[model samples]
Target: MTETLVVDASIAVKWVVEEEGTPLALGLRHGRRFAAPELLIVECANILWKKVQRGEVSREEAKMAASLLERSDIELFGMRGLLAKATVLATDIGHPAYDCMYVCLAMSRNCRFVTADERLVRVLHQKAPREIANLCVTLEQLSAGSD
Candidate 1:
């Protein structure tokens, strides 16, 4: 069976930006069936908005980025039941509630959680990589077939 990948906004954001591991993010998008918590849309839009405000991206670029994200084939997991699981995950991982949502979804779905947030990965790795199991991977790692 094909592996399912749960993508976080940090990794998804690289799909549009010319970042270091953008190719890896894009490759994953094309190579696997992707899923994410519904909060991903909000997070992605907020990131684009923040980039626009910071002058890192133009208004038009932000719109395009938003559209691109909407058009991707990723399946969005609903927030139902996820909140409680996320809360527990947050406490266990010492990550913020919102960040833990991605981890929770990945665990619930039995899929890998792919991210571009190095700090989050480090925390998961340091605290209890086995707790998260084989469910966490960085965009660079995913691109390199480490996922």
Candidate 2:
């Protein structure tokens, strides 16, 4: 069976940016299923915008990135059903509620929330409930799994 991962913007951005884990994140595309809240679109767009602002990516590259993401096979979950749980989780973890939405969705779907945000991982590793911690895996962990 294919593993379903709930990826946040950090992981998603790697798909377009030639970062350290870009290949690993790309590896997931073939045999795994990816999911995230609709919030991912906005978060990814903002990241792309920032990259453009920093001159790390040209406007044309950002547009291409956005187009590619729009065509990617990621399953997007709506925020309505996730809001309440996400809010409570955010409060509990002291992380932003936006990020918690991905965690909440992963919990609801009984899947892992894969992220590249080290601070978020560390915070959850130190303070989140064991259940929540168990639902998250870093990009490095996911990469190691293929070997």
Candidate 3:
């Protein structure tokens, strides 16, 4: 099976912005298929909204970013079973339920969990009693080898 990656909104946001980690996140598209819960759409929208509010992007730019995300090839997971698993993962990991949702989906689907949230990485490393079998890589890690 082609490798799958569970991408959180923090990293996805970099796909649109030419930030420090943008290239790393964008490079992920080359080797693996990307997946996320439908919640991703809302989360991404919220990021764009914040950028708009901060005057970093114009309203039109925000709309364009939303459109790009909607049209991306990343798969969206919405099954009830997946959500239940996510809830359990949230409890086990002691992270926000929403954050754990991505981790759960990745584990369930045998995929990597990709994010740009440094705090999440630290917490996962500290709290997950056992090593998570799948990769949980940050955008920096993804782009590291190239540079």
Highest TM-score: give the candidate number: 2
Top-down lDDT ranking: 2, 1, 3
lDDT of 1 by residue, 1-147 (tens): 888888888888888866677776778766479899999999999999999999999999999989998998889989888999778777877889898888889888988888888888878887755858468888777777774
lDDT of 3 by residue, 1-147 (tens): 677788989878878766677777778788678899888988999999999999998999888888988888889988466777667666877778888778777777777787888788767777764445235766676567521
Off by over 4 Å in 1: 129-131
lDDT of each: 0.84, 0.88, 0.78
Which one is best on lDDT? 2
- Best-to-worst order by TM-score is 2, 1, 3
Question: Candidate 2 has which clashing residue pairs, if any?
Answer: none
Q: In candidate 3, which residue ranges exceed 4 Å CA deviation?
A: 131-134, 145-147
Where's the lowest-lDDT run of ten residues in candidate 3?
A: 129-138
TM-score, cand. 2: 0.94
